[model samples]
Target chain A: MKNLWFHLMPYKDLPDDFREEHPSVWVDIDSGLLDAERVHQHYHEYLDELEFAGEVGFDGVCCNEHHQNGYGLMPSPNLIAATLTRRTSAPAICVMGNSLALYNPPTRVAEEFAMLDCMSGGRLIAGFPVGTPMDTIFAYGQNPSKLRDRYYEAHDIVMRAWQEPETFAFNGRYNQLRYVNVWPRPVQKPHPPVWIPGGGSVETWRWCAEMDYVYSYLSYFGYKAGAATMQGFWDEMDRLGKDRNPYRAGFLQFVAVGETEKEALELYREPAEYFYGRCLHVNPKWASPAGYQSEATIRAKVQSQVALAAAQSRAGNGQNGGGRPGPMGAARDWEQILDLGYVIAGDPDQVAERIRQVCIDLNVGHLMLLCQFGNMSTELAKYNTRLYAERVLPQIQDLFDDRWEDSWWPQPLEQPATARALA
Target chain B: MRETTISVGGHPVRVLTGGDNPSAPPAVFFAGIGGVPTWVPFLDRLAESRRVIVPSLPGFPGAADFRHLDTLLDWVVHCVETVEALDEAPVDLIGSSAGGALAAEVAAIAGSLVNRLVLIAPFGSHDTEDPGADIWAQVPGPDSIPNLVCERPEAWKHAWQVPEGAEAIDYQVMHTRAMEAAARYLFPFGDTGVVSRLHRVDHPTLLLRGSEDRVLPTSSNERFCAALAGPVRTGELEGAGHLPELDTPDDLAREINAFLADQELG
Candidate 1:
């Protein structure tokens, strides 16, 4: 339960008042604002926090891959992970990795991840996500219909490559392997722990539940949008009769804390706006292509948008939503975002309590917090990171310790010969 | 861990690197023409402690094939950028055979990014006195080795084979096509022109050659050392062919270990 993961990003730097006037995502700004020097400095700052996070007792720090987007600013998370291994000790190196299907053969992922695991002394947690349709279909030129199958096949090949002791043969629809073996197998026995990050899709949730892998809901659309999806996941676990284990689930949230709520809000306003407005400005072609998303998921997105509109209408009254922040109160106005307590922006005490309340409300076992969002300065991000590490993390360290008794929920399993066999 | 893949100029390239060691600078090893990463032995040795990366060229064994890559400079820039992205910045480069050509171009263009370079039997140009590259196919024999310094002509007689052009390897057909591609783009020998630019390279460089290399003469390696602007060092592995890492791994490893020992991991 003390495993607090931080998503540190180099936000597009802007003036303090940028957010007050513009209610958009921080990444929407032009690329001219960022230079190699700024990028270099920002990288060191984030690394400092990762080291600080471990020193403060968090089990790991998290970095992810995104390309041609401003929201996260990390086109190559492995680069960040490589640097992290030298900068920090004690924390596991977690990369919510390169999209499997987007890669050819996928054994490259196996090889690199194995290398990271070895270099880190077996403290590597590998993540596989059925990549976003936009990046998959448009950017990588994968077919939407075949995306799922390719992703699954890539995952299968990677796993086999990892577990196989010697060369074996594998011939699949997408990949053919006459000899299947990767040098430098992961240091962890039968490979390190595998976590599947999800975007609240039915297929992902069901698959994670069935496979008994950790389901990290990278909460971007907020808690409300995720409510039904998580319910479906838990319900599947119930039907499968798998005893509930908190380790099997995790969630991500954007967090910002200051000495006072006013100061925090003032600091967060501009960058938060940039994150929502500029960075996330998705071309409809990329974000929601025709036939890209399933009908059910598309409907959910539309419904979420409607809810956002209604909330914004209510917030226009200029009064908080009956003590709860209205759509505009704390929503940050992300596109179609259902602000269900995913974000915490306030003073240390207030934000800490908010985080605790959200964790309890969501029953989320793992909390991967994003301390740096949008174009927040490196110094400010470090301040938030230190404050959380020193002040807030201690408050909720025991929220889920000994919370589950399901010893069989998802214990490490010896690799079966079939799965380990060459492709 | 799964293999990491990225695209360069619409070509899918796979990169496999050693562990996360920020203090340790990254090193890139290029695949042989028509070759993938799994072909070499030194790949493992290079990845031992340093951050090492290798990319699959698009038209290799199983990748989407490109007709020919005319300019070695473009390929070099692509490789440098790919390596930079992997290490979050610049890195050292290692190349063998034709890959050595690409490595030299990368060092010339993105000179600042390369901390050091180790080129093995690099193929670009020889002096006017040396026989020009045969457009047909290359024949493999003792003489195919690039850095043979044996004074006894009879000793190298058995090692040298009759001149044969592109028909030497299974990838000869692809090399023929690549030659056509180069013909289309007028393959630039600018890397040779920029030999003096090697002095501009702030990082130290070590050139490794086989003692009995026939493809590239020992003089070429010596000229490479003299032309390099950076601190330059040269070494020859005895009883080695062009591919010494494959024929004599221990001697090659010892030479590399000796060179790397002098530099900081940073």
Candidate 2:
């Protein structure tokens, strides 16, 4: 379907003027209102937004986990997924999930995600991301060098728990549990579709293609910046003799829709600025040396229009004489981010056409849109949501509807008895 | 000293005391359900400085739960009376695990009496979902060995095993037998909400967590810090687990001393 998956980050109580001054990437709203009452308010509003996204004819909705940070107040995305199950009747509840290695037994994820699938009537799209260095190494206390290996181990454990029929013993480098029996088997036969969200790592692209999982580029960078990575992914797919089956590929873009391009740009400019400035702020220490990518791949991302790093640095230096440090300049520059096309603000028809072009260019099956970002107001987001669903969504509705009918992972899961009977 | 082995509402409780100078502040150490007088070494470090008392809890350690007391609330009331019976001018309380739940209840019930409090991985508040099955049992394989070791290897071995003198009532051994019988009484999930009553506790509080502790984890300590009514300070001793005093006595003693010194200064 050409329809976009729209997500709303309901942070309405943020300072009204935050988006005005901060870059769309970095609206550092003060956390003074982070008491229990405000937290509760955000929780309900966030749940409402998830339900609204599903109602708007989005193919799927997304939620992710972040901790001790105001950028995304979703410390527990699974809780949101649970709420989504009861609220929205359709749409996949995506939990760009529990960083595998951070959890003691990766089966905690296996069990919870399976439970989410059952609750959603098999509408779960499990996302296994080898989380960012900051999240993996600093926040979760995982060693940086061994991050991929731990993630692989976690992936294996969760997959085995879903697919293995019997109670088995899994002894891995990280997890060593004696009995492995996850209850409430997933509704999806073998498992729900697996989506690997990558930030342009060659290793990830090749692995996703090899495993036949949908490779979703979480493009916070813009379309032009993401071109190389997208091309690299398609190249990997080609090497595997894979067909351009849209379901195998997905791309996300930050989109804000309004009556006209000028209005859209005006409405989204500050929020977009905040997104580029405060929210994209990364500690230089955490940016880490570029790992697991060819020099050619790195250079390609640098040359792209989406080179956010340069724009960020220029903004960081107070390009508008704001002198406020744009948050993204703490690390790499415009060259690294230029190709990572993250921001896409325009009117409904313009966005719809642009998205269609993006799909055609990248040969991507899914288009994930972030209409609400960097403290964008709920009213503006809802407008974008309505416009996308009413105008843009219909334009590409039939683009891939009949192209792929079979699921990549459709094997039935083994329904094994839990070790402990509920007393 | 009004020393007594009292039978109250069916449970037989033994209380011992020291320091009765009316001007001296009162301190109570609620011992773990390990049955042995393991708190003696730790208490000796505090007794000379404050009016101190330690009570042996009923059940599992072979003492009878006189009224067949099966809940955390019942145990808590029994503890409050035990302190009141001494007639000391209120008491600052310290409790470990199940005892911590009792201490929290005492602070809730007799808020005026509690001057300062310390609770170490108390087991009694049953708010969180019952960790019904032992997580260790659910573990898939033998991979979590690093979680057990602290900086000192001998300390871990010592902490797990019961000492020769009172080997039968070792904390780990008592945990096995008493856990099944005590879990229902231990995980009184309903009791968790009352910790908010800590707001009534008008005294400074200190929370201690072991950095490498996998059993209770650091999240619990964070929750404890959030709930307590008064100002709270939390310290994590690296390379220590559930029994920090047993594993890293120096670090635990240093924290206790520092907290006490700060309290005295305040």
Candidate 3:
């Protein structure tokens, strides 16, 4: 398994009464709640922590884009990735990525990704995400119904701009460019490997399969809730007559490993609670705008809810994620999170065991370890990264590498230790 | 009323027409939130004297997805093509809620086809200050309309009468389908650049608001009134909410008739 350290530079100083005072953590997160000075402090701290991941032997260091969100402070992952490129010599500088649809002429993505690749010496894994409805639809004001269309068009333009030999004029419904040429062409042949991070959209599954690109499930709920989506993706790959190469898939899991299980449980409880409870308190409306989700997905969601409701009634679970929030949403405690497998919390042995199970079961070659989550102190995050790198990485790093060659990973990921030494 | 399909830019559009007389001026009614069913006795009442064309804008009920429309301006082109196909004089247009936003766009660009435009709680743009509550964000299941759409609980019976053995999930699919169109045109805030182009709407227009419409409070419409250059009048439907035609159809019809009559004779 290719273990990569993921950073979601979240605001750490939300008041204790945030759930009661603020209605949401995304889109409409109250500006009054943010302390600019503290954010400045957190930025430097988070960057230092991200830099530490490389020193601690993480195969890669990743950053992602989010807008108007308290949890994800990087609206422009490219900028952060650029900063990391200079400070760190991690095997891969994964920018998991710029929301492709948001940029007017998506050639911007091509140009930037090329710059990052060149700067990082061909060590950039490009992540093209349709983005969360809150980020793309609500925050940036893209039409949800047309978001995917824009995303596909943007993806096409970015690819052509990177790979095409000559300058080309592209005419698309959403984008029209008189001159389509990208300068500072990527260091990698053709372009850096593209990793599409999807949030359980079947359309994404089909697109990724057709393109033969990596279809990464950037799930918050870990393997338990994410199993269906992962299975669905592999099932899609099967339908498309594609091989079940684990390298074609990736999964993001929050992990908290310490010297002992009790140490992990005690150390991570507050941050985990802060992350899951306060960071995910998004308004239902903001989370899912009309047309953001496909019609089939909508129907499937409703049917699943109905099925879940029936199952709940049969078992008297009385859990509704919406409205009453009986046993779901931001109100969930750390124990609940552990029970649901949202986080893998234990000693290195236990953490390695659970993550290995995730790799084997989900058939994911890339395991994105979310070591730095909501409000984790820079000290704690660095320690978590170091612990995982030292104790757990040896256990699971070879899970699928012997069987499958991961084309989606940066070239350095092939010989990360050598790459690090040379750098 | 007769339901028919008309080609708008090669995409077959679902349309319902009634009172189609050769000489009578056309009065096209655009369904507010969902589709043709949302507008009840008001649509029938308008069709009594003139041709009332209610096309299920793509992704609403019988219509296909609105993805073909491309941009918000494409919707205006679709509306223009729709009006040109009417084969009648400038029609009086009535649009409610989400439909009102589209109708407003049509009136701003294709004012030649409109004698009078009536917008009922239209949402076409976003405003940072008074970002109205999103109806889709709330829980109603696909099978039923939210109570906020109606001022009185009993008012819902006039429109959303659930059929026997009807699946709530089906309605949920329809609800999402309708929302896809609306969110495409007007997301977060309902403000399209119509405010800048309001001068193009040379016809008399009436902006009607529901007294209890929390979804789109009337206070947020100040910019719209200021932007409108023609005899842009504002009125309130006494006890209605966002979807007046669903409940106060008679009252809505009376207001529409009063406005159209005065605009016609004057």
Tens digit of per-residue lDDT, candidate 3, span A1-423: 688889999999888888888888888889998899998999899899888888888888889999999899999999999887778776588899889999978999999999988878789999999998778877887877788889989999999999999889999988899899899999888678889998666788888888878888887887777787788789888998999999899899999999999999999999999988888877665666677788888777767677878978887878643211211253458888888788898999999998899899999998888998877888899889989999999998888777788878776433322234345
lDDT of candidate 1? 0.61
Q: In model 3, state the lDDT of residue A311.
A: 79
The lDDT of model 2 is: 0.62
Error of 3 at B87 (Å): 2.7
Candidate 1 residues A1-423, lDDT tens each?
645566746456544454454433321344554577876777777777676777677767888876544455676777777766566556777787668887787888888888777666666778887776445654465655345667889998988899987798889866887988898888777767778888666667678777667888875545554555566567767887865676677777778788988888777766666665454544332343223455456555546556666777877753322222222234555322223444577888887787787667666777788777777776787788888888888888777775664221212224311211122
lDDT of each: 0.61, 0.62, 0.80
Worst 10 residues of 1 chain A by lDDT: A412-421
Candidate 1 per-residue lDDT over residues B1-266, each given as its tens digit = 12677777666667666645656656677643324424344555655566666765545432433432334455555666666666445666777655666677677778766767777766655575664333212222223212232323333232232235622332333333333232222222212454555555555777887776655677667767777767777788887765565556666766665676675532
lDDT tens digits, residues A1-423, model 2? 534454534343445454355323212234563576866876776566667778888867888765545567766778888877777775777776577777778898999999988877777888888776556654554544345667899999999999999999988766789999999778897788898887766677778878889888875665765676788788878888987787787777777778887887678766665555555544443433222223344454435423445666766752321111224442123223222335555677887788888878877777777877766665666787888788888887777667675354223324422213211
- Which stretches in model 1 have alpha-carbon errors above 4 Å? A11-34, A295-342, A405-423, B1-266
Q: Model 3 clash pairs?
A: B124-B190, B125-B189, B125-B190, B125-B191, B126-B189, B126-B190, B126-B191, B142-B171, B142-B172
TM-scores, each model vs. reference: 0.53, 0.53, 0.90
Stretches > 4 Å off in candidate 3: A310-331, A412-423, B18-26, B47-51, B102-112, B115-117, B122-145, B153-158, B161-167, B195-207, B217-234, B258-264
**Candidate 1, CAPRI quality class derived from DockQ:** incorrect
Worst 10 residues of 2 chain B by lDDT: B133-142
